[model samples]
Target: MKRRLLLVSNSTLHGGGYLQHCQQQIQDFFGKEVKRILFVPYALHDRDAYTKTARDKFKTLGLCLYHMDVEHTVTATVIFISDVLFFSLFPGYEVESVHETPDPVDAVRKAEGIFIGGGNTFRLLKALYDNKLVTEIKKRVLEDGIPYMGSSAGTNVSTISINTTNDMPIVYPPTFAAIGLVPFNINPHYLDPDPNSKHMGETREQRITQYHEELETPSVLGLREGSMLLVEGNKATLLGSTKARLFQRGKQTTEYEPGSDLSFLLTDAQ
Candidate 1:
């Protein structure tokens, strides 16, 4: 069976519509057989709420939820054990939580589908690369047919390289070597309606334009809110209401709507 990679702009558990978007896509694609595993590294503050809410939402969606241990292996083990106990003692499905020890390379490789939660995607990419898990994750997606999904940082990491991010640049260039699952770089949380013009920070479009000019070779996709790219096999198609703008070095700047071909940028420099 072929696997599907679903990357979101952010973890939608905290009221962003991204999570809901992910749910709909999964439902549409996998239907009742959808199984989700959330890789959370930054949801410590509201751990309980996030977990309960995710379980409830998936239940409503008629999907099964599995959570990986984010910190303190014992806590994760406890959650997994408790779930096992519930399944053994009670009557629901078997939902397990595993302690995320020695990184998640093996686990990611084995999963049918994985979701990279929104937070500091750079940080996640850095850790994955440092631990040498990014390569394994990519191998799983490309070679072994595992469906991988990421939001915000997750979405950014799916690109050839992530140049557009709201977080301060803490990771180095080599560490930012993304999964390259898609041909173009992704600028999530993108915006173009900023006519107000008072904010000191560059608008999403402004930042991407600046990056494009500075790079020796650049191919960028500035994706705004509620926008995503659905990549299958070697081809990709833009999804959602917003238009996906492509910027490249040698080609005329063009904006494409959903269902258009993105393979051109793959051969284009940068």
Candidate 2:
């Protein structure tokens, strides 16, 4: 699969506007060829507002944004509501919701670029599974050479599983299986044990280790805030000002400094 992805740890930094930090990088990632973007706003609750927020951001990158299939919606009178189980895309226009289409699969095949926003990993996975978009997304990003972008929970779903996510089990999904766009899992917003905090809680490392003990999950890249992963084909590079920590069972936990070649992390040691 020849995949191209820009998976970010978080959307905003302290006091930063939405996607303000990565706007240039995002523009570079998708390149000038992608003029339209098929947006997946499932990870958010207020889908319309979320799409609207992203629309402004994507406009900065010179990309027009369109959202996906769902039931119930946000309008003038209703503020917050959305449902799932469909997909749709058309030419030279935008759809209000999935009600416009009877066939969702064929619609996805025409996608050129896709973006998945961040919020709840479980909910995102559940929506993908319920709507049967998992395979279609994989086909688009992994096989069809569509450029994909995700942040936080969006990045979480790109991994092998969402078991390492910090979100609570607020809702039940059919399975913990994620889109597996990448070979391993990711622990976004991975915090190092605070050097000064007196609060005695399981550190993020310990939490991931415990998850590994039970699940024996694949390697996990602990993506700190302000960091991101840029993948082109089989090569994955760590970008930003900070180092990203890597965790694998029976292997030394290591922190890869920015600009360090991270393509090795995409494959196991020889």
Candidate 3:
């Protein structure tokens, strides 16, 4: 059986329309027989950040959230710090709190569909690799042919490496380390037409351009909040009203309109 991957940007069950769009995308790809395994490394905000109401709405289509993390040499220390500072500061929701000593490869092997949530892509990538779970997740996708999904940090980590993310550089990520799940780096919430005066920041498109110049290897895909990349077997198609912008090495940027076939991108990535 072939697995389908649904890579989402940041999603808000209460505000953003992306959540409903994500549900439709998931249903379009996985159909009625789907099981969702969520990986929330950055769910530091709340234990049940992905609320039961949201999970239950999508659960009808076989959605489930698993507090999955790569337990390894590095995660041991991070988990300790997270437990003391992160968990103590805010105590209400359910935190998975997996032990650092246990192997993470087992978790990746059991998952059929993986959803990586937003926040700190670099730290998440480092934790995954240090725990030896990154290798297994790749195997699950490339070798086992399972569906690999991402959003925000999840989408950013799927690239060869994401040098630029929207958030501040709170942690220095391991250089050139990532899941390599997707050939292109994704800038979610991309293309902010207007600028905010309070924050000193570059627009999403501007940041993506800077990343392309720095890496000069992998291409960058700019996906707006509601847009997603749908992959089945070796084929990929763009879903939603938004268009996808592609920035390749030594090539002028071009736009692929919505409903256009994206089989070429998938072929190159594979």
Best by lDDT: 2
Of the two candidates 1 and 2, the one with more favorable lDDT, higher being better, is 2
- What TM-score number comes out for model 1? 0.72
Candidate 2 RMSD to the correct structure: 11.1
Flag regions of model 2 displaced more than 4 Å.
Answer: 62-104, 268-270
In terms of TM-score, the best-performing candidate is 2
The lDDT of model 1 is 0.59
Error of 3 at 76 (Å): 51
What's each prediction's TM-score? 0.72, 0.83, 0.72
Give lDDT tens digits, candidate 1, residues 136-206. 76777778766666677778877777666666666554655688776667777665756777878766666
TM-score rank order: 2, 1, 3
lDDT per residue (tens digit) for residues 1-270 in model 3: 253567776664336444555664655554433344535454234526444434554444322211122245675657556544643443222212222224456766766556566767666666666667767777787777766667777777776666645666666655755766666666776765574457666666666666767644567777776678877766777776678787776678878777777767664542
Instruction: Tell how far residue 70 is off in model 1, in angstroms.
Output: 37
lDDT score of residue 199 within candidate 2: 88
Q: Which stretches of candidate 1 lie over 4 Å from their true place?
A: 1-3, 10-18, 30-56, 63-103, 170-174, 250-252, 266-270
In model 3, what are the clashing residue pairs, if there are any?
none
